[model samples]
Target: MKRSLEFFPVQLFAVIMGLSGLTIAFAKAWHFLNINYFEAIYKVLLLLDTILFFVVFMTYIFKWIKYPEAVKKEFNHPVKSSFAAAISISFLLISIAYYDYAPSVSIIFWWVGAPLHLFFTYKVMKFWIEHKFEVGHINPAWFIPIVGNVLIPVVGVDAQPEMVNIFFYAIGIFFWLVLFTIVIYRMIFHNPLGKRLLPTFFILIAPPAVGFISYFRITFGLIDTDSLFLYFIALFIFVLLLTMFRQFIKLQFFISWWAYTFPMAALTIATILMDSAYDTNLTYYGALFLLAVTTLLVAYVTYKTFIAINNHKICIPEEE
Candidate 1:
């Protein structure tokens, strides 16, 4: 009760991220495949995602009020600080999910999420500049802030001017390149990620996948050499991760496992978009395969999450 409220984690917002991404992925599948069941599933998930956003947001709000120090500690934390952007990313994901069904409400979320995400980007970049973080502190989760920037254009193309969307798109793509190098370098030169953080390796798939989707949105669905490169880069990473499946399967679950969901959703959506543009059997079947995987992974993670909650495994003191 009160203890749980005090221990409520900001990272819990990633659940909304996973759920919102699943909703949008299904919505895209319905649009492309015209599958009747996809529509109902997406609609239900959207409503549930909306409800969960407020629940997690309000819980963190109370936690912030009661334990400002805890909130501040997370904000200053090298790894946890990256997840603060998940709160803004959740809002943006909901905006994209609602764009078709409720544009008016979607714009309101975009308006709030866009600016807040920019603020987080600035705050995090500033933190990195001011603090003396070791290479050991870097991980794929660092991509979270950068990924949110490119995502702006998914709905921003219609909600705001083209230049505004491009502004965000540029920031996202550029930083993604910079950070990708850093993360890869860290992995090659330093120790491998710990068990709890290993799942965040999946985040490596997000920036390029989201970049592909955002690029098409900014260009009004104009497929070109650059767009193909972005999509393929993401696809290659997805395949690379599959080769490591045995490694991932052996690890114990952590809240960070939610990191697996949204990026797969982004890549699934990108594959669907490529199918829509090129009308190829390869992309079409690829999209469906990825969609199924994303759905199953999200469901499994959600089930594990609830079990952890019920067992009081979550919202307890952090493991050393």
Candidate 2:
């Protein structure tokens, strides 16, 4: 097999998912801002995302067909296989993105993604139970499937059985805490993460943000004490990661860095939801501040990525 095609990793799916999800998140933010051109911006994003999504999807399908052994290696690796959930998550977000445009169509994608996500959750957790435990190997990627559970309700409440969606929500909320504790413990006691994996630490910002957004959706947009808890927790994590900016900036750019994008988008979207629902002056400004920060970070990442790609720096097999 040619090196270029062989170098593609299933984890690269994260890029499409993260970028598409960010587009949707920013779409919501612009709508909230009553931007005059929000519709055009959103439609363009949806179009671009649709094209990229299918191209990557087909590329992966071909990889699996042509290189089954390589696929097996990735699936067997504890850390890499956890990323398979990103495929389903991408489907879920694609479903959500199209939810309003053609709800019946969206339901089809949701069903397709949701069942696969359930299976992924089972497979990954089973590996943990059946394999030898290692504290150091734990990474935020473990939270990917669990976070998808929490996120199911965000769109599932509209597309599927309410009980099923609520079940997903409960699972997400429970394990998010469980995994957060273990991951944080590992981070504090273990050596620093490898440079390439450093961007994934930003994933810590996501669960609370997504959980807060899901809580708002489940409650049908009511404000309450739990809302306060989720929002404040997300805010704290955002600030915590922000304070460690030097660590992120010093690291060389890589596709994994795109992992940092959607979490911030989730954080931004959470604040926007709070602002609209709670009618708080602070939340109003807070949303814009987070928006600015997320926008700048994403822009910088995109710019560096373009530079890297032009220089052929991103296609390295070791990094993938």
lDDT of 1 by residue, 1-320 (tens): 22366567777888888888889999998897667789889999999999999989988988899889989988999999999999899889999999868999999999999999999999999999999998899999899876679999999988888889999999999999999999999999999988999988888888999999999999988889999999889989989999999999998878988989989998999998898887788988988999999999999999999998887878877764
Q: Give the runs in model 1 whose Cα sits over 4 Å from its true position.
A: 1-3
The sequence of per-residue lDDT tens digits that candidate 2 reaches over residues 185-228 is 98999987788788988888888888888888888887689877
What would you estimate as the lDDT of candidate 2?
0.79
Model 2 worst lDDT run, 10 consecutive residues? 1-10
Evaluated at residue 294, the lDDT of candidate 2 is 72
lDDT of each: 0.90, 0.79
Among all candidates shown, the one with the greatest TM-score: 1
**Clash count, predicted structure 2:** 0
TM-score of each: 0.98, 0.94
lDDT score of residue 74 within candidate 2: 78
